[model samples]
Target: MTSPEVDFTRRNPTARPLTDKERDALDEFVDSIHYSSRYNDDHYEYRHVQLPKQMLKKIPKEYFEPSRGTLKLLWEEEWRGLGITQSLGWEHYEVHEPEPHILLFKRPMNYQPPAQH
Candidate 1:
C-alpha cells in the first residue's frame, strides 16, 4: 500500500515529483509492505535445536507462548547473530519450546523475494 504522497505522484506525473526524502520514504514504505498473496504457500525448512537450560534465561519475556508451552521468536533480538539464524530468515523464524530447553526454528527454505523494477 502506498502513502498519500506516493499516490499523489502517481496520479499526477506532470505535477511536482517526489523529493529525495519523499522518494526514500516511498522506497522504505514499499519495502515494508508484505505481499502475503505472493507467498501464501511458501515452503519452509523446519529445523530445531536443543538449547542448554541456561540459555533459556536469555529469551525475552514477551516471547513465551504459554498456551503451547513454547517460545516464538520471529525477529532478530535473541538468535539472529548466529550463523544458523542467518541461514534462516535472520530477521525471521520461530522458536517453539515443545520441551524444556528445546527450540524449533521454522524458516523459508528457498524464499525468493519479488523482483523490484
Candidate 2:
C-alpha cells in the first residue's frame, strides 16, 4: 500500500514523445524476457502459476475450503501454479469462490540480480 513510486508527481507537465532509441529499447526489452513458463525454461525462475485441475483436486480438505482472503490467495496460486523449490515443488491451494476465502502464505520474492562488486 505504500510504494515510494506512488509519490512521483508528473502533475501536468507537457507530454513529450518517447525518443527513438528509448522506443526501440523499450520494444526490445518488452519482446525479450517474458511471461508464460511454457515459453521459457523453468531453470531457476520461480513463478506463481495456477495449478492444474488434476493437481489442485489433491489439496488438503481444509485448504480446499478457504475464507475470503484465503480464497483470493488460492485463486492466484491456482491461476499461476506458482513454481517453487527450483522447479521441484509447488504450493497447493483452494478457493471457496461462492464465499470469500482467506488464507496466508509466505511466497518467494521475485528474483533480483546480485549486487555488483
Worst 10 residues of 1 by lDDT: 3-12
RMSD list, candidates in order = 16.5, 20.5
Task: State which candidate has the highest lDDT.
Answer: 1
Off by over 4 Å in 1: 1-42, 66-69, 81-84, 88-97, 112-117
Tens digit per residue, CA lDDT, model 1, 1-117? 211111221121222233455344334223222212112224554445555554445444444546655554433433332212234252323343345555444445575656769
Q: What does candidate 2's lDDT look like per residue over 8-111, in tens digits?
A: 12111222333454344334223222222421133322233333333333333333324322322333233232221223232222223432221222223444
If candidate 1 were superposed on the true structure by all CA atoms, what would the RMSD be?
Answer: 16.5
TM-score of each candidate structure, all chains considered together: 0.39, 0.24
Model 1 clash pairs are: none
Residue 18 error, candidate 2, Å: 51
